[model samples]
Target: MKIHINQLEEGCILAKDILSASNKVLAYKKTIVTEHIKHALKAFLVNEVHVENLLEDGRGFLPSGIQKEASNEEKEKVELTPVKTFHQLYNHAVMERKQLFTGWQSGTQIEIAKVRQIILPLISELKHQEGEILKLYQYCKKEDYLSHHSVSVALLSAFLAKRLGYDQGEINQIAITGLLCDCGMARISPVILTKKVTLTEREYLDLKQHPVHSYNLLKSIMSLKEGVKMGVLQHHERMDGSGYPLGVKGDQAHPYSKIVALADTYQAMVSERPYRSKQSPFKVLEQIMQHDFGRFELNAVNELKKAVIKFSAGTKVKLSNGLKAEIVFVDEQFPTRPIVKIEKTGDITSLKDKKELYIQEIF
Candidate 1:
C-alpha cells in the first residue's frame, strides 16, 4: 500500500499494513495526529473512549509510503541492550506489592536487597548518561512499568541535576526525590491500579490526588528534606498552572518540582503505559523540546537534552529507511541524527552528513 507521511500536519498512513492500536505502527501524518493517535490508542486499548473528541483529528488526511528493508547485516548490528536485571527488579516490585496486598506471609527481603544493590550503583552512574538512560530503561514491560518508571526517573533526574551543575548532594537529592516520587500510589486501590480500561473522571481525580498522598507518605519518613517533600508534592504541577493537586504556576513551584517534572514527563513518554506503547526516546525528547521554552525551565530542559544524547552512545537504532545501525556517538549540537555505523557494507552515516537518511525512531 502507498504511504504518506503528512496528513493532519504530522501523522502517517499505511497502505498494506493493518492498522490497530496494539500494533507498533509509528508513522503519523502530522505531529499532532501522531500524538492524538497515541493518546487515543492508549484510551482505546484500555477502553478509555469517554473523551469522544479525542480520536477526531482536526485536519484528517491520509499519507502513504512504500515499505523498505535493511540489509541482514544491518539488522544484526541493531540489538536491544539487555535490561535483564532491571526488568527483574521491576517485576519484583510488582510481585512484592501483590504479595503484600494479598496478605501473603512476607518473604521477599532478598529481592528488595537485590534491587537496591543494582539500583544504587546504577544511580551512581546515572549522572553521566543523560540520553542513554531511557534506552536502558525501555526493557520494562507492562507489569513492571510503574516500578521501572520510578527507577528510570530517579536515574534521569540524577543525571540531569549533575548536568545542570548541581553538586553531589543536590544530585543525590534529585535522585531520591525521583525514587520516591510515586510512593503514594502504594496506598491507592488495586482495582484502579490494575485496571485494563481507561481511567474514569473519578479515577483520574483519584490518581491526581496521588501527589498529596505521596507528600503525606514522605512526611512519615523523617529523612526527607523540605525540598524533597515539596518535590514529591509538586512534581505534577505545571508552569502554566495546568497540572493538578495544587495549581501553582511559574516561580511559585519549587526548583526541585521543575526538575522532577521534566524527568517524570521524559520517563513516562519513553516508557510504555497502559494506554500507549513507548515512543522513541528521540521523539520523546523532540516533544519535550517543543514544550521546553514555555512549559519548562530553559536551562534544565537543555541540560536534560544534552544528557540524553550523551547516554545514547553505542546504541542500535532503526532509521526511517528501515535500515538498522548502531550509533557511534551523537553530535551535541545536532541530536536527531548522529554518527551511525550502518551494517550494510559497513558504511558510516552521519545524520548531519547523510543527505537522504533520517532516524525514524530509536529502538
Candidate 2:
C-alpha cells in the first residue's frame, strides 16, 4: 500500500492520513491520490504514504510508473509522431479545455489524469523551446476565448514561474493553477459565458463567485496540493484587497494564486474580447507598475517584465506606426522600447525618444 510520491497517479485511494513533519494532519485517510499530489508530497517532504490496493473505482492496481519495458515499435511510434508547433499545441490544449469545461458545466466530476494528459506535454514543449508563445493572444477569437484564455494563462504562468526561479515541480503545479483558475466559471450560466453585451450588475456578481466555485470543485480532491486548490480559489484576490470572492490580500493569497492572477490579468488584457480591443503587453505591464501597484506581487510582476522585455540585436519587430524595423540595440534600463533601424528609410530611432511609438510585435 506504501509508495513514493512520484509514483502517484489518479484513482489511488489514501489508506492513511498525510501529515507534516510536525505530525499535523494535512489530508485525512480515504482521500483520493491524484492531480497535484506529487507537488504536495514534495512540498511536504513526505517520502511515501499508505494507499489502498485497489483504486478508488475498485479496480486492481499497478503503479503507472512501474510499467513494463516498451517494445522498439512503441518507442519508434512515439518518435515518428511529428512534433507540434507552439500554436498547434496551444490550439489542441484549448479544444481539450473546452470539452473539459463543458463536462464540468454538466456536473461531471474532474479526472485529474485527463487534466495532466491535456496539459503536461504542451507545457514541456513550450518550456523546452522558449517558442514564440507570448503572441498567442493574436490568434484568439471571440468564440473560443474562454479555452484560449485558460491555455494562455497556463503558458505565461509557467514562464513566469521559471523566471521567478521555482523548481520544476512547483512550476508545474503553478501551470495547473493557471489552467484551472477559471474552472469555477463552468458553474455560471452559459448565457453569461457567451454573452455579447455587458453583464447586468446581478450577473456580474454571480460571475465573481467563480473563484469560490472553482475552490469547491478542486477542494474535494484530497491528493491535490492545498496551495494549488487555494491558488485556484484565490486567483482573483488582490494583494491590496480590491479583488473578489474572499478579497484576501497580501500573504493571505497563496503565491501560486498571485502568479495565476498576474498571468490571468495580463492575458485578458492582451487578448481581444467582444467588448474591448487588446493592448500591448508592454503598455499593460507599464500600467500595472504605475497604476495597479500594490494589487499584484512585485516579484511576479518583475519576472513578467523580464520575460516580455527579452529582446536582442537584429531581432525583427513592428512599430506602432506600422513600419517594420530591426533591433539595433536594447538598453537594459529601457527594455520595453528597444532602439531599432527602420526598414523604410534606414533611419535609426531610439524608442525611448519616440514616446508615441512602441514595438508592437517581434516577428
Candidate 3:
C-alpha cells in the first residue's frame, strides 16, 4: 500500500522503490525499513513509499496523528496544473513547425517572424518550467522525427545558452538557430531522409549539404541576427575540423554555432530514427565526453553535461543486464557510470567499477 513517508514504521517491507524527483531510487523495493532508512528517505526528499503487507492488514490509510489538515488557501496554492496541456502545447508547436517546413519546401520564403511565432511560446514555457518540459520530452514517446528533433535542439540550445550566461535576447536567438538549423533538410528528398538503408557515397555527400542549404535560405531574412544565421550555417562544423560544408576548426566556428552543434548532436543521438533505436541520454553524454571530446567545444560540452544531470539524475533506468534500477547518484568525473540502486535487492552498484554493466534505457 502507498503511504506517506512520515507514516512509515520500522520493520515494514518496501513494496516498490521510492524514486526521487530526478528518478533516482531513494529506497529499494523489499528492503526492511529501519530508522536509519527513514532518515535517508527524508534526506532524499521522498514524501511517500509503498509498503508490502500494509493494505492486507487494512492499515492503508495514514495514521490520524500523522495526517495534518491543510488550510484551503494552502491546498489551492499547492495544486498542480494538468501536464496534459503542456503536452498538447508541445504537439501543437511541432505541428506548426511541420507546416513551416512544408511551406519552405513548396517555395514559400522563410520568415524570421513566422519562425519566431512558431517557437517562442514553447520556449517561454520551457524557460519557466524546464524540469516539467524535460520530463514531458523524456516520456511522451512521439515519433515525428523532423519536428521532434527541431524542438529538442531548440530547447537544449536555449538551456546551454543560459548556462553559458547569455542575456535573454541572445538566448532566444540561440533557440531560433536550433529550431531552424535543419531547415535545409526540407530540401532533401524524403526517401533519402527516411531511408532504412545506408546511403551511397554520392548520396551521403548530397545529404551533407543541408547546412549550406539552411544558410542560403536564412540569409534572405533581413532582420535575423548574423550570429543566429551563422549558427545555422556552421552547426555541422566541428571543433576538430572534421565537420561538413567548410571544415573550420577551433576558434574558427562561431560560439553560437558550437552551442547549436553540440545540442544538435545530443538531440539526434537520443532520438529514434528509421535505422536505429534511440540511445539513453546518459550513455550518449558519456560518449560525447569520451570519444568525441575534441570534436565539440569544451565549455559547451561541460554546460550540457550539467543540464543533462539535472534533467536525468533521479530517472529510472534499465541496465544492460536487464535489471531494473534507479539512479541514486551521478558522478561528475564519471557521468556515464552513475551509482544506481537495484530495485529488487536494494544493493547499490557504481557503474564506474562495473565495466560489464551499462545503462540501456531511461523511463
TM-score against native, each model: 0.62, 0.75, 0.75
**Each prediction's RMSD to truth:** 22.9, 11.9, 14.0
Cα lDDT tens digits, model 3, 261-337, are 99899878887776777777778888999999899999998887776677667789899899999999987877788
lDDT-better candidate, 2 vs 3? 3
Q: Write the per-residue lDDT of candidate 1 for residues 1-363, one digit (tens) a residue.
A: 122222222233322222232243332222223444434333322221111112254333442352223234423322323333544544544454344323312321213233334345556444333345656446656676666677777777777787788998887777777776787777677778778679999998888888897787667555557898899898998888888788998999988888989889888887777677777777677667765557876788888677667667887788868899888988877776689998686788887777577665566
Q: Judging by lDDT against the true structure, name the best candidate.
A: 3
| Runs in model 1 lying further than 4 Å from the true structure | 1-121, 125-132, 328-333, 337-342, 345-363
Kindly report which residue pairs in candidate 3 clash with one another.
22-314, 22-315, 23-314, 23-315, 24-314
* Model 3: residues with Cα > 4 Å off, grouped in runs: 1-84, 132-143
Return the lDDT, model 1, position 178.
Answer: 79
Encode model 2's per-residue lDDT on 1-363: one tens digit a residue.
Answer: 777776766656678877753355655675555444535565554668777866555443546654434334322222123434677777888999999999999999877777776777777777655745567688788788899999889888888888888998998899888898999998999899888889999999999999999989999997678988999998999999999788889999899999999999999988888767777666677678779998999999887767666634677878889999998887767767778999989999998899999877666
For model 1 the local lDDT of residue 288 reads: 71
The reply for model 2, stretches above 4 Å from the true place, is 1-79, 312-315
Error of 3 at 66 (Å): 48
- Which of 2 and 3 is the better model by TM-score? 2
The residue pairs in collision within model 2 are: none
Report backbone clashes per prediction: 21, 0, 5
